[model samples]
Target chain A: MVTVTLNGLSVDLRDRAVLHGISATLRPGELTGIIGPNGAGKSTLVRALLGLIPATRGAVEIDGHDIARMTPKALARLVSYLPQGQALHWPLSVERLVALGRLPGLGPMSRLGADDLAAVHAAMKRADVLHLAGRTATELSGGERARVMLARALAVGAPGLVADEPLAALDPGHQIDVMELLAAEANSGALVVTVLHDLTMAARYCKRLLLVDRGMLVAQGSPQEVLTSDRLRAVYGVTGRIEFGGGSAMVVPLERV
Target chain B: MPEIPVLRARNRALIPLLLLGIALVAIASLMLGAVPIPTARLLDAALGHGDPVVRAILLELRLPRTLVALMVGGMLGLAGAALQGYLRNPLAEPSVLGASNSAALGAVAAIYFGIGDYSPAVLPVLSILAALASLALLFVLAGRAEGPLALILAGIAVSTLAGAGISLALNLSPNPFAAMEIMAWLLGSIENRAMDHVWIALPCIVGGAALLLWDGRALDALSLGEDGARSLGVDLARTRARLLLGVAIGVGGAVAVSGSVGFVGLIVPHLVRPLTDRSPSAVLLPSFLGGAALLTGADILVRLIPTAGELKLGVVTAFLGVPVFLVHLLKERRLW
Candidate 1:
């Protein structure tokens, strides 16, 4: 299992501070959702955590190893990332696209071995894109593409998975399917961190939620603790009603505060 | 799924077939020059039993020309595929990206200043330096700009500036002979190129090609775009550095010898892409082989076309490349 530790993380983009000093310990075997409004530095936080972007004034440690000291391939073998709204530049087949996730594990001259193929097949089966393997990724429907991209991420077979807005542009049904898959992934004993926009979905699926507002972590706890009406009004600038029922929380924003 | 294996088998067969084609074309190139040698005589020459005149012609003249064509063409195609893959833009090629022109300008400067008269190495060295400068300029101008249009615009600007430099050198030449030499080189050809040219260019081209080929996996990852690729642990900075240096060296060596041959790089990859899986990495080796065949074939055509003066190899490539490029632009305007 992996534990991600953010130590006084701050990110400055072009001299403007986007993420202020924040620290949190994210444990594995849980689905943790980062929920925030637009321009809330949610994406930046994830990028910095994955070492895609350098932290301006802090350090990120994965299981006590400083991320800055780890090579990209080393970090990638530990955590797989799926960024939002990816554009396919080539008409690569779904199988080929998914196989790219194994890049971190393979050497420069090595071909995909049997184990790699098995991982690809397993990931495709898990993401329910096994049937679409022969088809071109560019021609797939929005929902199909989303799952294919997810399968690509899953093919990494890393201990930690960080996905940014995987539900964006997906239909409600597809959204539910994706959430179920992520939850299953967490249940299987992997760290699953997702940046989500749907509060109700986040509350229902994620075991823990980190509420970010203007680059600061306002609350970090169970959905009921973080989704309080006062915090919603102050951070989201909306008056929302949240009801806990059937072992889950349902959140609905009535109107702008 | 059955079709997948069949398709893969077909793709797998392409490289061997291309090699065979290059061999055939090289022989045809050897046999059918200004003074055509019959196959029997060509074979005899190969076995060292032919007439000494025929042997000299085969070994001295056509062999160097054919080797130069293959090397220059292969470098161009490889560099083109690498650039297109790195930028994720199909329009990126050595000439289109201003690499060839800048290298050509450097060679012209070398010749104009009489440094080339001192040694054959001076030309390619200066040209490689200029190509590196152009690539650096290209990154500074279009590196962060969004969309394919920005890169194309930056390339055009670089090409125009390099073209102006070449023109200024030509316009202020110390003698008419220097000006004429500069003009002929600008048109681009492999005619009368000796083993010296091949030796001068081969090392740089091979080194550059190695650098380009080394990053095939990284190029494949780049299909996901910068952020996604980075997330997958592809080092963008290192990949970009390799691409720039590779293209610069390859284009520099090519233009130093062949004098700014254009469109071979652009055309070969397009032709080879459909036969492969269409991954950026998959397109590379085939493009190189196809490019070698194309230039050798074009050089053969240069001999057979019955012109009062032999047509320059660069001019023929432009003639062959423009229509294909236009068709691509018309059919895939959205790609730009």
Candidate 2:
């Protein structure tokens, strides 16, 4: 198992700081939810973690190895990322799209071997997109496309998976389906960190939550500790009630108060 | 996934077919020029056993032109596939995006100012420099945007600016004959071109094509967007830089030798896209072969057209390519 640690990470883009002094440790064995309002720098934090952009200060480390120093391929072997909106350049079939995930494992002249193909198959099956493998990713519904892209990320089989708003365009059913998939991945010993907007799903499914607002981490703890009524109102500007049912917490937004 | 096994087998067989087609077209181009050589005599001339006149025509005249056509067309197609894949835009190409025109503008200026009269090398070197400048201009105008519209707009801007530059140079020419000469050069022709032009362009084209082919896997990963691809081990900045340099060298070399041959790159990749897997990386080699076949075929057809002065190769390609391009545009009208 791998552990991702962010120590006082600050990112400045074109004279403007998007994330400021953010610190957190994301560990394996739990699905950690990063929830924030729009423009809370959630995506920026995730990008910094993946080493897509350099941090302005401090560092992100995977098992004490600084991410900034790692090659893109090396980081990819340790962590897989799913961006917010899936961009499909061609009308590639689902299998080929997912097979792209195994790129780090293969060399330039190497063809996909039995093990790589099997990993892809397993990832597709886990994402519940095995039936859609023959379909073109461009032609799929938004929800179905999300799952296919998720499968592509999972096909990497990296120890750490970081996704930005994976459930943004999904229906409630697909949301749960995706949440269960991430949870299963976590249970299977991969660290899964997803940025979620739906607090109810985040509370019910995410074992830990990192709450951010205005470019800073407002709070981070278990669902019961982080999703309190005062925190919701202060951060989201909504008066909400948290309910406990069937051993899960659900947040019901009362009104914009 | 099950269908992929069969498709792979089909594509594996089709690669050789494409190569064979290119070979046939190359041979046909050699055989069907003005004053056609009989097959027996052509083979004799090819192997150094024919009349001196036949040998000169085959070896000195046709051979260089044929080689230039093959390299120029293949380079265009390969560069087109590479650009399209990098920008994630289907419409990206050397000529359409004004890179060729920019190179031509530079070469035309050189000829107008009498630099080309001093040495043949001056023209291509200046043209290559100009092509690189145009790409740099395109990046500056488009900024960090990654969509088709931004790139297309930037390309059009660069193209129009270069066209204006060419026109201004022609208008300011001291002699009227120079104007006509510049005009003919701009029209692009392989006729009367010697081995010198071939030697000038071939090395750069081959190097650029090799560099482009090396990035096939990275291009595939890039379909996942910048962040996703980077997270998948792709070095986005480095890849973009290499693509820019590769296209500059390849397309620059072609334009330096042949002037601005339009639309072969755009048309060939689109035509070949359906036959192969839709991956941009997979289409690079086929596009190269298809481009060679298309240009070689066009070059030969230009010889057979019976025009008073042989039709310019650029004019021929535009005449054949623009309508096909329009049809593609209409088919994808919803995108606009």
Candidate 3:
């Protein structure tokens, strides 16, 4: 089983502290949603977890190995990351774009074989962008590009997947569809952590929620515990109304506190 | 699924054609110089069986010039592709960004100081060192935030600084003859070069190109951008460092031999990029071949043009390259 642990992790950017004394644990088969408002260090936390940034204090450990000590190649085999925006410079075909995720698995001189191609195909199917395989990634619409980027991340088939705002440019329907895809990925045994802005969707699909505000982890637990009206009012300055149906939780934010 | 393999196969098939093109152009360049050598005699001279005069002309003159042309062209093209791929900017090239000029300045400094008269090897060594130093300074000044405008601006600044330095050296030279020597070298040419020049440049070019070609896979990963590529286990800093040193050595060697031949690097890659799979790694080798062909062809064109004192190769490239650059700028006008 894969487990990612953050021991009092903190980050300093340009001498300004962005994340401070944040501790969390992500386990296999758990889809964790990180929710925070603007300037709340959500992206920074995700970047640190991916080892894209150095933690100023403590450490981020994956399966008991300090992430900083692992080689990039070794770390890549365990963690797959998808950044927020879809920034494609070249007009590579959609299939080629997804195949980039297979780089870690392939050797320097080794070409893709049946297993790698199968992973690419499976990722495309999972992200529902198989029809756009021949299309140029740069020409795709916002929602389509989001799906294609997701396909790229999924092609890694790593033990842990982290995405920053995967649903940003997507419409409501695609948003729900992507959320379902992420949930399915978690169920398949990867520890999925996503930075999300949609509180209702996070409550619905995420098995655990981590709330951050002003660089500190304010609360962490199930949706019913972390999405409490008191914490929502205090941290987000909005009153949250929670309801349960069919064993799923939905949250509606009332007027600002 | 069918289209992906088909496209890849087509791209792979283009490599041999590019090699063939380079061979044809090299032959044409060797044959079409000041005194045309007949085909049979050219072959005999190539095999060291001709009259001493003909063999001297063939081996001592034409072959070196042609080889230098091919290598410089290939170097320019390869450097352009590597820089463009690494920076993710289509406008990145040694010449356009003033890297070649910086190298030229270094070589000219060697001549002005009379170190070049001591040994031919000193020129390229100094030039390559200058190219690396200038580029390092550029990265330090610009930092990692490579917006299109920021990169172009930084290139302009470096180019201007190198140009000013060149002017200062010329003005300070004690002898008018030394100044003239610097000026001729600055104009750039593949004419009158011997086997010695080829020997001096060959090693640096090969080493630099090997370094660049080795980073091909990493360059492909970089098409995903810094964060994405890094996340995929590609070390961005190391890849960029390797690329800069590679370009510096290759461009520096080209400048020392040919004296600032610009735009082959910039134009050839743009010309051949459409034929590839839109991956940086795929673009590199083809760009190298296309460059060799273009420079060899351009060298032949200048010879056939019947110009007064022959048009400088650098001038021919600038006249052709600048317009294409302008067209690209026009298309990317929104960057302004």
Backbone clashes in model 2, listed as residue pairs: none
Task: Let me know the TM-score candidate 2 reaches against the reference structure.
Answer: 0.94
Candidate that would win on lDDT? 1
lDDT (Cα, tens digit) per residue for candidate 2, span A20-76:
899999999999999989999998888898898899998999999998889889999
Report the lDDT tens digits of candidate 3 across residue range B177-225. Answer: 9998898788778888888889878987998888888787777777877
Question: Alpha carbon lDDT of residue A54, candidate 3?
Answer: 87
Q: Which residue pairs in candidate 1 have backbone atoms (N, alpha carbon, C) closer than 3 angstroms, thus clashing?
A: none
Whole-model lDDT, candidate 1?
0.87
* Candidate 2 chain B worst ten-residue window by lDDT: B1-10
TM-score of each: 0.94, 0.94, 0.93
**lDDT assessment of candidate 2:** 0.86
Tell me which residue pairs clash in candidate 3.
none
How should the candidates be ordered by DockQ, best one leading? 2, 3, 1
- Candidate 2 wrong stretches, greater than 4 Å: B1-10, B96-98, B133-158, B326-336
